[model samples]
Target: MSENARVTKAAGVVGAATFLSRIFGFVRDVVIAWFFGAGLSSDAFFVAFRIPNLLRRLFAEGSLSIAFIPVFTEYLTHHGKEEAFHLARSAMRLLSIILVITAVLGVLLAPLIILMIAPGFTDSPEKYSLTVLLTRIMFPYIFFICLVALCMGILNVLGHFAAPALAPVCLNIAIIFSAFFISPYMADPVTGLAIGVLIGGALQLTLQLPFLIRKGFYFWEKAVIFHPGVKKIGILMLPAIFGASVYQLNILVGTLLASLLPEGSVSYLYYADRLVQFPLGIFAIATATAVLPSLSRQAAAKDFDALGNTFAHAMKLVFFITVPSMAGLI
Candidate 1:
């Protein structure tokens, strides 16, 4: 098969899996809507969920995957598997340590974080406190997700797209189960949703583990905080982080504005955004995830022609797939 044909097939595989996952995600949201409806409790949960969800996808699915693949591909192509595995280990270990610290800080500072994030809730201490409580419960999810993102980066480089793409389906399934079976038992339905997040995060991580192991992923027992490859990834990540933050920044702005409106405005926007995410997650992200490794390999080979061709192919695919969805949403 032609290189372009091979790349297209991989993208198709990723897109198909991602599409399924997004469908389940929509179902999960429907379950949430049925049980929680739109109210102060739902608003609090949305605010709490939104902050971490933004960071989770940005780091795990967006910036981290984009940054890691090129450097990792270079290591694999030039330095051999052992050296590449060292790079992966170093990066994952450092990422793990950082996520743990961040999660801890997020929990400890939940009240202050809530004040800054959703200040409008201050007038209603119950809503404000519930947001804080849920935020803390969900903060540790950052740790599980960072590992999942790193695993996803590794798997994508190895041409293992299906498992990583389908991993998110586990998260949706966990949430759906919680909403239907667990939420009814909780005094606050949102608590059940919060617990589901932790469960889903673990499921996301665990689902990718065996695949990663099969790819001969070498995980370091100790953190290598200062590896050169990790440094390279960090340098690449800084600008990509800003670039990725555009979407999150928009959400932050929207949430700030939404908090000032009627009590349930945040919940309404949250529901709408979930619908928007369906296509964004399925098409745009799948293309990005599929294209990055191919681009990285071509760039590492110093084949500018193939590199340009791959990018062009990706752009065309993304444009054709997303334009209709964008129009429909509008």
Candidate 2:
């Protein structure tokens, strides 16, 4: 097959997987609506959940994927596979250390973060307590999901897209199951949901293990944190984070504004935000994921012409699809 055809095939695969994940995500949301309904408890839990999700997008999925894949892929392209693996191991070690620290800080400071993000919850002690509990339970998700992102970045760098793309489905399935079966047995439904998140993240991480083993990346060992490639990724991550974090910040702003409204307002925003995420999940995200490693490889090879072409074509395809999607959403 021609290079273009090969690229097209990979794009198609990611597109299909993204579509399935989004579909399942919608189903998962529908289940939440049915089980939780729109209430203060649900509203508070959603608000709490939103905090880490915002960070997840800003860091784990958006920034981390964009930054890590390129650097990781560049190593694979220029330095070869072993060098790439070393880079990944180094990056993973750095990521694990940083995320552990962040998660610890998050646990210690969940109250302050909650106070800032959902001040309205302060008025209701019961709801406030519940939200705090849920936030603490769910906040560690950032750590697990970021590690998942590392594994995924490595997978993408290796041209292993399907399992990485499919990981989100496990989270969706976990939520759906929790809502249907676990919630009924639990004293508090939202607690079940929160527990499901930790479970889902674990499961998501688990799904990547076989892939890692298959790729001979399963052994756990440390890599030097100060490696040049790792340092480059750390540097690039900031701007890439800035570029992608705006939408999530927008959601947080919406949530903050919505918090001032009636009881179900936060929940309303949550569900609407999920709807918006569905198209984004498929189009922009899939395109970005499929293109980035390729772009990185091209960049590493100093093939700027190919890099520019790949980016332009990907941007064009995104516009071709996302324009109509935005219009339809409107």
Best-fitting candidate, scored by TM-score: 1
> lDDT for each of the candidates?
0.87, 0.83
- Lowest lDDT sum, 10 consecutive residues, model 1, at 217-226
Query: RMSD in angstroms, all models?
Result: 1.4, 1.5
lDDT of 2 by residue, 176-248 (tens): 8888778778887788898888889889999998999899884475567778988888888899798877877
Tell me the TM-score of each prediction against the true structure: 0.96, 0.95
Evaluated at residue 257, the lDDT of candidate 1 is 86
At residue 162, candidate 1 shows an lDDT of: 93
* Residue-wise C-alpha lDDT for candidate 1, range 1-330, written one tens digit per residue: 766776788889999998899889888888888888888989998999887888886787668878889999999999997788888888888888899999999999999988887888888988998999999999998898888888888988988989988988998999899887888898887888999999999999999988978887846444466789999998888888888899788888899888878899998999888888888888887887888888899999999999999898889999998999899999
Model 2, runs deviating above 4 Å: none
Which pairs of residues clash in candidate 2, taking residues 3 or more apart in a chain or in different chains? none
